[model samples]
Every structure is written in structure tokens, then in C-alpha cells.
Target: MTLSDASSERTRVYVLQSRQPLTTDPAHAFPADRYDVVVVTDGTAQEVLREDVQAGPVTVVRAARDEWDSVVTSMPPDAVEIVTNDEYCVAACARLRDVVGLPRRHPTNVDGYLDKVVMKCHLAAAGVPVPQAVALDPVVVAARDTAERAVSTLGLPVVAKPRREANSRGVEMLEDAGAVQAWLARHDGEPGWELEAFVSGDLGHVNAIVRDGRVEPVQAGRYLGPLLGVGEGRALGGWTVPAGSEWAARAHALNRAVVDVLGTDGDFVVHTEFVARPDGRLVVLETAARAPGAGVSELALVHAGVQLEIANLRLQAGLPVPVPEPSGRQACWLWLPVPPGRRWDAARDGARAAELGVDVRVRQVGREGNDGASAAVGASVVLVNDAPGGLARTVDAVLNEPWFRAHAV
Candidate 1:
């Protein structure tokens, strides 16, 4: 393209983010010349803005939470604009909804999707098969009744957690009523909790770029578990792509149904996890409206042949989508969330992780029991392909690792 051609293009997009998001496998720099203006919200990426890494004219505006409403509402109509899923972001999008014409999935859709309880309830009503779970409003849960509710509704084998937590924080899997009481005591004076049926099955995940109620799920990706023992809630194992099989197909169908059922009204990206019960059933376990955490942003791009950041932009702009057909490649990502409490031997485990054919990277590393998604110290991620076929073997390897075995509670 010549200089005139480059100048002739009349498209621009603004990414609302706190930082230049980290993805281990991306080659695209921030959109520069392609966009007319890039606004840095809250000045999180001010360095990027100051250095003018962006090819075009960039403006760095530092505004606080209170000032956002007045500013966003005052924006002049412009090119394609989108924002991440945050409370302030939602308000900003609402302020500029008509003028910017962002994908319908802006702040409002994001607001609804972040709350787990609402997402579950919405999916169930939308015709998806969800686990037996109860969502509570912010009413504080008494330690005593919390136990009774678990026993009465979810029964002996159950999982409990706060509705608003991420990384499975505060999640517990209890096999006996006594266990629920003990766990509830830990909460003491916290507000509300959700008790879910303790579901056991092979875990499968889905990442989709959806707009106008139509879903383009990248594919079902399966996760290997026992990765966790009793009461552990972190996802320490890696995942595989190209989930192909009768069971995987069913899981995929369930993903579509769940997304369509709890469907967001506008353009949005969703990540959901389905548990394939041993008894030939499926349960929708986890769902997120924003892009997935734990490094899946890169995994989705590499495995599914889609650029998630760009997809998020298109959906918000009401423009054409660019998700392509699969590249028939196998890829995997591990959530390197180490176990909490137990002092696991890391040296042997790191070697074992590589031996299991894992491309290992740590997402979190802190104090033992800090990343508390499980007993794990921090989050770890694994990337691989041939997801369904290779997943089981990799999981088996993870379970047998000395580091994993040492920390098993």
C-alpha cells in the first residue's frame, strides 16, 4: 500500500485496558497507524502512550473513577471503539453507546457476565444443563445455615464458594456435611456463598467470539484433573485442543446451548468450562464473559486461528468478524496454580512437567498457599496441540509428579 492508500483508510479502534496485556505467543504490537486515536484510560499504559509506540497520534488521558462518567459521555462520535469489561468501562461505553457504536456487548453485557451466579442461572434458563447450584444475593450467610443449605440442597458431595470470586478463590469441595460446617466456619462473617453439587468428570473448556446471539466457539478443549485432590480448587493441569470425540461433541453442543441460553445481547467473547460426568452427562461448570485469564488469550489465537483482541473490537463495532476455521493443530495451556499449604518439591516437579510433554510457564508464583486456587503456590500454564488425544496422558503425568504428589492433601 502506498502512503496515500494508508492515509485514505478511515478506521480507528481504541483499546481500554490497564496494561499492555501479557500473552506469550503474540506477534501483533498494539494497533498504531491503523487506528486514528488510542486513548489510554487511567494512564495504566502511559509509557506505551508517551513513547508513542502506537503508529498513529495517541492521546494519554488520566482520569479517576468519578470523572469517567462526565468524560465518556462527552466523547465526540468517532470510529470503531471498544472497552474491556469493568464497571468504569461499562459506564464509559454507556456514555458513548450511540456515538461510538461499539459492539452491543459493551459494559452492560460485561456487567452481567462477571457475576458467576447470574451467569449460571442465565445459562440454565437458556437451555443449558448446569450443575445443581444455588446463587445467593449479598445477604450475609450465617456459618450455621450455610452448612444446612449444603446438606439439604447440594447434599454430602458439594462445592461452596463466594459468588463474586475469581481463580476459584473460596471454592471448596466437601464430601460430608461435617466438612461444610468446618469450611463455613472459615468464612466467619463473609457475605453470601454459592453451594454447588460436587461434580466429577473430565473437564472441557470453550472460548467463543459471539455477536448477535450467534456463537463461534473455537472448539471444546479438555482438561485433565486429579490434578487436584480433596477440597483443592485450583486448575494446575495443562489443557489440550481439538477436542474430538462423541463426548467432546456433546460438550461442544452444551457450550453453544449454554452461551445461547445465557446469551449476551451484543458482541462479546466468552470462555466456559464443561464437566463431562462419567455417567454420560455434561455439566456447565465455569463461565466468563470477558477474555479468559491464565494465558488463554494467546492459546485461543494460536489454536483457533483467531485474534481475540481484534475480535473483541469487531463485536463492539458491529463490524464483520474474522474468526477462521481451525488450523487442525493441537495446542495446550496449563494453569500452573500450585497447591497451597503443603511444601511441594519444585525441582522434581519442574522436570516432571517438561517430561510430560508440557511447554511450561508460570503465571503466578508467590508464597505457598498464596495463589490459593488450589493448594498451589501460583498459577502455571501449559501449551500444546492435539488437545483431546494428548490431554489424558499429560494429566496422568501431572498427577504422578513428585511435586503434585507431595502436596496432595
Candidate 2:
């Protein structure tokens, strides 16, 4: 095999660690013998130099969290690929990749993927369906009259959110004109507030791998309940829509459209959320270039046969991406939010959640002594079960059981 051959030649890979670790092991796709792996972490040395990084002949570099660009710029020119599963790190990774002349999404276009305001604008311009939206200028949003004028076009029950945050952070649905005014008053000084019409429909999502304009179905799921109506500190859980169905195809197509509009130079992982109207129309909510967080990647591996971490790395390495077919197995996942000021026995609770079914897989739970924990604060459970309906029922039962809420007070 010549050095020009992609499959035969060894590749040097650089992986940047997000606040959370990779969903699947890096070695799954790139065997140690075929790849030289270097892991860079923003975390403390003690935190990142753990079992996984030590398990292989891998080098760990500890850098200040904000110095990712500098770290990448200084890498040996021979380093062939750079990738990160972190959504927030996409821009810096793109910048570094561009600097090294690596094939990936252009750094100039990442804002359209990360920022909701810019994202909707691009989608709309591309003739993709998106909820009506307006970015509230800071000065106008602070004034009652101007704020009302800014939001008038979006109509009542508008959704307000920060332009750049994810996992629905700073996302809220305002019911009426008064609610809109109150939301503006609460977020008075904060800039980058975007208001959109609250589309009424079932919230659905599609995760897939797109290479050269082809999309492979990862998993299509629908939210079991109203996401924003639950208010703060609420965990959103849902079941995967049965694969190989009409609805699933629409979701996949919508995801593909998002990728086409965003325009990536090579294969990329897409996590797109959309709303499915009762009239059978699918409207895109937003899309991200990185793998979906909160164990959705695990769900895809279990039910859809796609290893996202591997696919992402493979694409970055310029290797041919193998699309995985859906297994037709029903699956469900949940991000259980742990309330603040309470200690949790992660092991015991995880076991109880597991006992819900034989196919249950509980990825993680918050351990004791961790207070003020919420989903955003890194306290949550990532559970997937074979029984689609059973997963939600079991989770609800466990959450409601008085004994289940044992506080380490």
C-alpha cells in the first residue's frame, strides 16, 4: 500500500476533549496500530489523564480551555485530522482545520450552524421551512414599545432564546403580549435574544451521517411531552419513531436539506431537530454539525447500528464513511434532570432504573455530594431501553416514587 492510499496508510489524529467524553471509544474506528492518537483536554490533568487516555499509547496535552486554537496551530504539520464532539468547539476546530488546510466545514460558515438567529436566516434563504423569527436588537428589546413592535410580526406564544446556546438553554415560550414583555424585562441587558413564532406540533429529531449528499438514517424520535411547558429543571424524554416509515423518511430528508444548505466540504454528522405538524409537514427547528449530546449517540449505536464518534472521526480522516442501516428495534432515551441542593446515590438509582427492563442501559447518574445539579449543571441520566413505551413509564414511575427521591441530606 502506498502513502497515497487512504485505507492502507497510517493517519495521525488529534481529538479535543469536550466537557464530556466521547460517546464511543476512539479506537473503535481507528485502531491503535493504524492511527497515532493525541488527546487534548481543557480539563485538569488529573481529570483527563484517566483510564481511557491511559488505556492506549496516547499522548495527553493539558491546555487552558480558551487556548484551543493556539494548541492546534502549534501541532506538527504532519497531523492529518482534527475533530471534536463538542458543539461549542466546532468553530475553533474549523479554524484550526482551515489553518492546516484540512478538508472540513469552512470556519466562516459555522456561525450559521451554532447561532439560531443566523441559522434560521440561512435556512429561510435556502427555501427551507423554519419558524418565523426576528433577532431583537438590544436597545429595542429593552423598551416596551419597541419590544412589542419587534415581536409583533412573530405573533403570540413566541419562543425566545439566546442565539448561540444549545440544549434549549435560555429557550422559553411566551404565551401572550404580556408574557413577551415580561421575558424582555427579565432578560433586559442580555444581548442576542431571538424571538420566533411558537410552532404547534410534535417535536421530532433526526440524526444521520451525510457524505457527498447521501443521508443515512440514524434515529428519528419524538418528544413525549411539551418540552418548554415543563418549565425549568425538567428532563425531556422521548421514544424513537419506528424506522423505515414515511415520517422517518421526511425527517431524514429535512436533515439532509439542512446539511446541503450549510455546505460542508466533506462528510459530516448532523443532529437536526424539527417539528412535525399534524398536517404532515416537517419544519426544521435547528441543526448542529457535531454529534447529539445526552446519550443520543449511544441510542444510535444500539438501535441504528451507527457509531457516531467513529463516523465523525472517519470523515475527518478522509476515509470512506460506511453508512449503518437501522435495526428496526424500538428505543428511547431520557435526560433526567436532578434538582439542586440534593445528594444522589447514582449507583443505587442507576440500578433501580436498570431493573425497569432487561434491555435497559443506564449510562450515568449524578453521584452523592454533588449539589445544585441540573442537566445544564452536568447532573443527569442517559437511559435507553428496548421497550419504547416501557422506557417512559418506568422513568416516570421512578421519578414519582417517594422512596426513589432519597436525599443525602
Candidate 3:
């Protein structure tokens, strides 16, 4: 599984991206002078020209919607692989892989991960425990009686969400038929709305590296509160539970089951979440075939000594998977709230954050003119502590502070 055994000294890789600037870090995934990498971005070349490109002998192709065929036609015919780390970019990556004859998840089948209705159906067919769900198409969502019918069919207190969105966008709980109708009325004609029976349980997520059709090195964590239930401006965070613990074992098993059912191939990261019921049963919430985003990888590195991006690259490059040692330190990552016009100084806030037991800090505060109601607007704070409740208590105390109010703009 060494680099020499994986592939030849000269290889080609193409990366698909939506808008984020592409970097050259993937060069390290291979041997020195081994890879000729090309990054295909949905943005224009002028857009990413100012970015810091970290890797060389690397080419960046800014692809417009209609120019994808032309871009692929221009690539070196022997491209070994194509990859992407985004949920929205999966299909593009898959298409590129297929065009280049590289191994990847089937392009047509990616809807099993992007579309909630498709995902739940696959889970249900595989005998996986999923919340009862019904899909509402554009026609159904636009009708006046849609929500009433949905409540009649799916029952009350159901969660309604867009089938194709990420980051919990347009996800809300409807307590009654009226609320359902109101929600549908506001979202009329939008496609892919799914009404799912609410499952009350402990919310948790398992992020794992799956390779050779198996799941391993799984990490489990708990959300500070209901992730999708939070209002527009609310902040939420998660921390890693030490590996090989009781819950971690169970989560690993569940993650394996999910990958097995999905028939995922080769090496990829899976973000699977579940709800552990009070009666001791677990229900599959949803799963995505991508690395956990929003500093979860940083939490993993701090607590488990694994850099997910590097591992993912190595795996995709046909190299050995680096086994990470568990650091046995508790870690928590928080998306703190900030006002639209307010300026946040992480250096000053680091001292305040330290008082709450965040000894290790990685803070990124949003800039001005950003949407304050968006969780992406705040600082992403990573804290490390030895005590079991240290990170949790710190997060709670920080959330209780006046400046952390979710209702503020």
C-alpha cells in the first residue's frame, strides 16, 4: 500500500469544485513529481486566479455549464482519477470520472445521496431503519391542499426539508396541519419537499473512512442541540467521543451497515447520522458520501490525529490509508453567532474562550456584509480539554452570553 506500489511516477488527477478556490495540496498525496493534477472549477478562471494555489504542474480549468464537454475533451486521456469534496459537486465529479474512465460512484446513482426521497427509499429497501417519509413533488407542493394531505399521510410533528439541499437549508418541523400548509404555501412550486415522521431521540453523527467496501476508523460525536431545528441565526456545535468507546463501536457498526447497503466502492468518506431512541433502537437519519464539513475534520485531527483531507487524497491516489492514533483529548467545534456589522477578534475572544476550557483554539470569524442569520457568518471555534464535560460546559456558557444571541442580526 505504499506510494510506489499504488501507481506509476506519472499520474493525472482532476478535481471538481463548485466555487471554493482550489489548492495544490493533493500533490503530497503522491510521490514527489508523481502527479499532473488539473482542477476543474464551476467558476471562471478570473474568479480563482487570485487564490493561493498550493500545488504545481497543476492546471486549473474554469468550466461553465455548457463547456464541460469541451473541458473534458481537453484533458490528458490517461487521467487516473477525479474527485470532489462537496455534496453539490458529486455529480460533476462522477461525470468527469466516467468520462475519464476513472473509478467513482456512478453518476446516475448519486441521487441516492443527494435526494432525500431517493436515499430513504434505498434505505427502506435495504431494511435499514428510517423515519417514515413521503415525497412531495412540485405539483403536490404547489397545491393548496398539499400540506394538509401530507399531514394526513405522514402524521403531525413531521420534519419537512428540501430533498436536494445541504447544511440544513429549508428544513423545519411542522407541529400541525396549519403549519404544514403555511410552510408549503411559502415554498410553493419548489420541488423535492419531503415530509418525514419525527423521531424523538438522541441526535448523533458518525464520520468514517470507508475503503475496500468496508467502514473503519469511525468517529462519533453529539450535536449541542437539534441541528436542523435551530432558527436562522442559532449556533450549534459538536465534539468527538473518544474512539473505541461503547457508543463509538455501535456507531461504527451502523456506519458499516450504511456503506454495505449503499454498495460504495474503493475509498471515500461517509458522514452518517442517526437518532438513538430511548428504547434502545437506532434509526438512520441520513448519510452523505463526503467528508464532514465545517471544521469537523479539524476536530478529528485534534482528537484523533487524523487529517481527513490528506487521508482522502491518499486513498483516492491508491496509496496507503494512514492510521491515526487517538489522542484521548476531548474536542468541541462551535459555530458562534455574530452580528452583521460587528467585528470579532479571535485573539481577544481566545482568552474569553479559554476561561470556558478551550485550551486549543482554531477560530475563523466571518467578515462584514455577510448574512448574520447564517451560521456561516460566525467564528468556527475548536476547543480541546481533558475533562469529560469541559468542552460541553464551555459551549453552554458561551451560548448563554449576551453577544451570542441567535435572534440578533
Candidate 4:
């Protein structure tokens, strides 16, 4: 084919990345022969690499987050596809599509996906069960009656969180009115805050792929505890719910309902988290229009044949995604945070993991003395097993025996 023919045939994809892409091999994800990929980054994340740019079919462009609009506008007005797994870039990608005169490919309810308050409202409107919430803007937050009204409406022990942040950032549980007032005092001028009635239950998530507006359920998993408890002397871990199990079925049903109400008119991956209340009620917590963080994607790869990040990228590039099938195996991912004043002991941890089995994969190791909030994760663990209950047993051993070892700096 001539250059003109090849260029015309190849799909032009603009991947807005905030962090490292999930796939280790970018070439494989966006093949040179099929895609003309331009990776736009804010330089805040270490996503695009020298080798990726040097290789064929990929071009890297650096633009500060604030300048993304201008950068995209200055580009050639040729038709292009927008793709991003970054939660912060979801709306930006959607808006940029209009700027480039490309048809929208994201969920029509983009605001619902980005803002927690909006999301709950949308779900509740569709008769989907969600936590009772009160949106607090700057004006409402400043009023003296705001805290009292919120506490009265949602009752005590309310969960206050930023309306748009992910990874449980700025989430706090206020057990009393005084605590709520104090929390509000700290954010007197900020916007995008919401207070919701605390739901005490087991936290779980369902991941699915949406193709041509069809919601394809992938894997449902339950977290060991709330993600907010990550830095509070709690390890973050989760295991895939066994396929065909009651828990998986309930999760899948809820996931479908969520996607349906959230306007599933496009191809993408949806990560929806819900709470399984002790009363046997499943209430939707939140949903994101992107791949989940941590090793959840890795777990999906083992549980089924789909890795969510790659699937999301493919969906955006107009490429075909794999139809996920349960592999009749189970997988789990664990994140161990290094205690304050301690550093990770990779040798001891590796040895202990080996003793457990060869299925264990140590995905990440933190730097020495990196005990800050952002760098608190000392190690990441992902493992898979075929034997019945083998995955849970291994996870128990890892937690009880504590495979993640650390040394004082």
C-alpha cells in the first residue's frame, strides 16, 4: 500500500495518559501496522517512554495539564480517536473529541462518572439503590447550619469525601457532629465535597467491558476492607469472586444496572464499587469510566483472558476486544504498606513468597525509607490458583504469615 493508503487505513488514536500505561509492551497494544498513535501527556506522569516514541507508529507530545486544550486544538483537524484510562482526563477526553470534531465515544453521562454526588443522583433517579448523600458546595459548606443539617439528614457517622477524587483520597468518617464541623472547617473554601450516610458492609467491585453499548461482565471481587483504611495500619487486598457464585451473580446484576443507568452508549471499561450490607442489600457506592488501579487489572487477566487497561485502550482505538471467559481459576491482589521509619526487605519477602508457591508475583517494590502517604506501598502481590479455595488459602497465608517483610531504616 502507498503511504496515503496506509495512513487512510490506519486509525488515528490520541491516548491521554496521566500515569504509566498498564501494558508493558506498548507496541503490542497499539500495533504500528494498525494504529497511528499520538500519546499526549502532561509530563506529570512517567507514561510515554523514549523507546515507545523511537519505535514505529507512536508519537509523543508533552503538554502541561492546563494546556491540553490548546495543544489539541493546534493539532491537524484530521479525524482522531481519544483514549485515556486516567480518571482526571475522562471529561477532558470527551470534550477534546468535540474540539477535534470527532464523534463522542464515551458514556453520555460523563459528569456522572467523574463526580460522586452526580453519580449517586443519577443512579437514585433510575431507582438504583445508592447511599443517601448531600452535595456541599463552597457556599453550603461555609454556612454554620451546613454540618448540623448534613448530620441530621444523613445521620451520624457520615462519610465525607471529595466529589471527584479517586483512590480514596480525602475520604473521612465523621462519627459525630463536632467531627463533621471540624472536617468542614478544614475545607471552608473548596468545592466538590459531599457527605453521605456511612454504610457498614463488605466492600466489593465489579469490572466489565462495554462494546457497542453492551455490558460484558468480566470479574467481580471483594476487598478485604475499605480502601480508606489503606494507610491506617491496614493492608489492601482483594480476591476474585468465584464464577457462578451467588456473590458474583449479584455483583454482575448490579453492575449491569449501573451501566444502564449511567448511559452506556460507548465502548469502554467500567469499574463499579458497591457495598454488600449485612442486611443482604447491595448498594452502589461509585463507578469510574476507566480501568481500576492496583493489581486488579492483573487479576482480571488471570481470572479471564481480558486485561482491563489494554481492553480500554483497544476500545478507544476502535479495535476489537476479547470476549472474557472465566478460566476456572481464581486470582488475588495484595498491597502491603511499609510501616513508618521502615524500608522494604525484598530478599526476605521474596524468599517467603517462594516458600508459599511459584504462582505468587511480586509486582512492585518501594524504595527504601519511602514511608510517606503516596509512597507507603512497600510491595504489591498478585497470584493465581486453579485448585478450589487455593487462592483464598494463599491470601490467608500471606496475611497471617505476613510475607511482606520490612526493616527499620
**Model 1: ten consecutive residues of lowest lDDT:** 21-30
Candidate 2 lDDT over residue span 1-409, tens digit each: 1122346656677787756556566776667767777777877534443222224444778787677667776756564678777675677777778777776643347787888878888899999999998887653255688557756788888888788777666788788888888888888877787888887789888888867656666888877666653224565666676787788878888887887788654567888888988887888888887777655666777667876766776676666555777776666555544445554565666566557642223222334433543432223344455565666666667557543443544
Segments in model 3 whose C-alpha atoms lie over 4 Å from true places:
1-12, 19-37, 43-60, 105-109, 229-232, 345-347, 350-376, 387-389, 393-409
Q: Give per-residue lDDT, candidate 2, residue 255.
A: 82
Give candidate 3's error at residue 115 in angstroms. Answer: 2.2
Best TM-score goes to which candidate?
A: 4
Candidate 4 segments exceeding 4 Å error: 1-12, 19-25, 32-37, 43-60, 73-80, 138-140, 358-367, 371-375
TM per candidate: 0.70, 0.80, 0.82, 0.88
* Stretches of candidate 2 exceeding 4 Å from the true structure: 1-12, 17-21, 34-36, 41-60, 64-70, 105-108, 138-140, 185-190, 226-233, 341-365, 373-408
lDDT of 3 by residue, 1-409 (tens): 2234345546666666665433225555554466666767777654332132334455677767577657766656554566666567776777766676665543235677777888889888998888998787654465657666777778889798778877777788889877887887887776677889999988888887877666666478877778853335566788888776888888878877877777667576778888988986778888887767655766777777776655665565556766666778878877765545444554455566566554423223343323544444455567677787676676777667643432322
State the local distance difference test value for candidate 2. 0.67
Q: Candidate 1 deviates by what RMSD? A: 6.5
Better of 1 and 3 by TM-score: 3
- Global lDDT of model 1: 0.56
| lDDT (10s digit) by residue, model 4, range 1-409 | 1123235466566788765453434555667776666778876434554211224444777888788877667656554567787787888888887778765678887988889988998899999999999988653365669988998899989998889888787789999999988888888878788999998899999999987878998999999787866565578988898879999999999999999988789888999999999999999999998888877887898898898887887776566778999988888888777667767556776677778774333333344565465436666677787888887787877787655656676
**How high a TM-score does candidate 1 get?**
0.70
Model 2 worst lDDT window (10 residues): 357-366
lDDT of 3 at 207: 80
RMSD in Å for all candidates: 6.5, 4.3, 4.3, 3.9
Candidates sorted on lDDT, descending: 4, 2, 3, 1
